[model samples]
Target: MSSGGYKPVVNTVRHSITTVSKRKRSSISEPSNNHEPVVVHRPHTSLAPPGSSRKPSKSSRRRRRVRKERSSSSVDRQWVFSASNFRNLKDKLVLVSYNLLGVDNASNHMDLYYNILPQHLDWSRRKHLICKEISRYNATILCLQEVDRFDDLDSLLKNRGFQGVHKRRTGEASDGCSIFWKEKLFKLLHHEEIEFDRFGMRNNVAQLCVLEMNCEDPESKLCMQSSEQTCTSPRRLVVGNIHVLFNPKRGDIKLGQVRLLLEKAYKLSQEWGNIPVAIAGDLNSTPNSAIYDFVASADLDTRLHDRRQISGQSELDTKRSPFRNQHAVSASQTNEWSQEELQLATGGQATTHVRHQLMLNSAYAGVPGTLRTRDQCGEPLATTCHSRFQGTVDYIWHTKELVPVRVLETLPTDVLRRTGGLPSEKWGSDHLAIACELAFMGEGC
Candidate 1:
């Protein structure tokens, strides 16, 4: 493919990586798809021209904006806030979730990205871009999927004062889930690696970690934890990272993997005095799909869904729960096999109803965003864009203990279309990174 959609920008100065930055920037425009374009109103700045000494007047700035708008429209991929609580909030943290398309996988799946330019898919070049894109966020915590190049990422992020743990997927999949955190802010208290293959959920895996805040009280300024013997640790949070299976046909396996991860996360939370929990990754399930509904609502009746179309990735199945699994099985020729699949998905409890106690909320859904970039539920219209499919499958979900202050919005579909697909010169992967600033909720509020 040609590099016709490539968009380049001036590189910014590198800053110390110890502290996460909350700065925002305007994103370049893309080729138009069938979706409507979002026009953002950029805030007027007093920044003087290159070598000019004096700041331009209001009228001149207005003229400049008019010319820029006429030349091209752009989307603001910045952190959006509903309120100013974050300004006064203490112990605030920024979390980012991304799926860095693995090098080996990318090469093996060239047919899936035939429309992408050869240079854009080059691992050597893409790796640098990936690091730079991630560095821009300076997130306090990162939940990454398809990270086969953990050593490279570790070296790059280590300079930023981040410590990470990697759990490679079982079987032949080279990519795995990795969780990285700012060492200055959080200390690793406990961690667990889960391989779903053991539970008949295939070779997918998940990573869980209990991160303890390195400070004393929430009211006091953050201080390094004392080395002396301390009976109790400070406030903490449970971080769960997973890349759910991508096979849309195996909804039963998908649900089983998610269920196991959540179960593990809940157990870890209880062991740590019920700390807040945040789960992030590429779930491979669209918003409002049966799997998504199960995660958000914490209950799902397996009998109401079809095992083959549980993730809602199939266009033929629009209803979250179209029909009873038994009826669908009986209607089809694979009655006995489908029956066992239902039991496997439901944990063989002879019950269709499944529930969880996490009470989690999606960060993007909790925060309001522009109509251009967000859906009715406030989720990015498309997190992953490629030649075959372009839709949302990545998310950052958290418990009630953490409240979303601001979220890093994704590019609009129109903007993405300009690139003809993903893994463009501007983006290192097919999926856009999603991030959010979360604050610990106060006792009363």
Candidate 2:
């Protein structure tokens, strides 16, 4: 998109898509069925050198929430909430999930924090605010990825009457998935987690957990063979949480991991009475990719198994390294996207929607005709904002049987850009957390 003509469009509806990041960063593909596709491109390399001489203003500095070095004792701090203090979980079920980035002190993009956005650099403050954001939602379940400090997170929420399950990447110090739920409202019936250390790839993991909801009334209108109160079986839900591999070059691996996850979930669901399910994660795959659609696909084979592999072919390159080879850049992310890629990426939102139509549906898919660009929080849909990658990579999807009620409030694009894409003074995490409320189709309050 050209600066002379392109602009981000904000849908008036609450569940509107705040698409097009303008000049601040990142491009998106708007695929259409008949006409040529519209493409929004991402900023590949740094545009300017650091320290150009101008200093930041007070208001700009004030906008940031800073935390000075304090006692390390807060890490040891713990709180315990009484049973009466817990939120009512039966009436509403909100799930919030985020890629907390990580606890690594030295990262490739870490320099950008000090050199460019100095005011937005505070790891201690960022951690606190990330926990605060998670608490504010008071969601029924919290699925967190890129959680290096699982112990700290577990400790933080433990006092709030929440229990967590963590699975670290094999042979890595950090980088893992953590799933937390209110102890009083849910009981873990079964758990299956996989570490995708296959295909000579870096470690990535997916976790599936079956939770039985603790209903106050035995007859709390559960979904079973009979809609009667005769069955004493508790209501159940299956949740899939993942931190998908990030190499655009190894899309094959990403697709395979997703397919394995879906297949596992399907088999587990079938063995467990075909329970309702919800999947939350940092997929790395864009909304238009075939893998994104395949998550909800009931009968689709893995992209690796398909004889005629389609979708994302605009990006299939033999020269591309198995990993993100800086020496071998993917033209789609760095340079001008080809017309065919644009047609795949920028085709009108409707065309992608039609292709993405699946057995399961996104909680925030919204009505027909609109693209699946709305975040679970109903804010600007972009989940990630960084110098390298800025787009919606996080999602909350539920089976069609679980009707979506509403999405939580998320950070607006204007506010998000102010901090220059996450790890901001306002919110923690480079990847924005997303949440939505869901209810059983036939169950009424």
Best by lDDT: 1
- TM-score, candidate number 2: 0.64
Cα TM-score per model: 0.76, 0.64
Candidate with best TM-score = 1
Candidate 1 least-lDDT 10 residues: 1-10
Clashes of each: 2, 13
Kindly report which residue pairs in candidate 1 clash with one another.
Answer: 30-418, 31-418
List runs of model 2 lying over 4 Å from the truth.
1-92, 105-108, 111-121, 198-201, 216-231, 296-358, 367-380, 443-445
Q: What are the lDDT scores of the predictions, listed in order?
A: 0.74, 0.57
For candidate 1, write residues 176-223 as lDDT tens digits: 999999887788999999998888889999999998776644333433
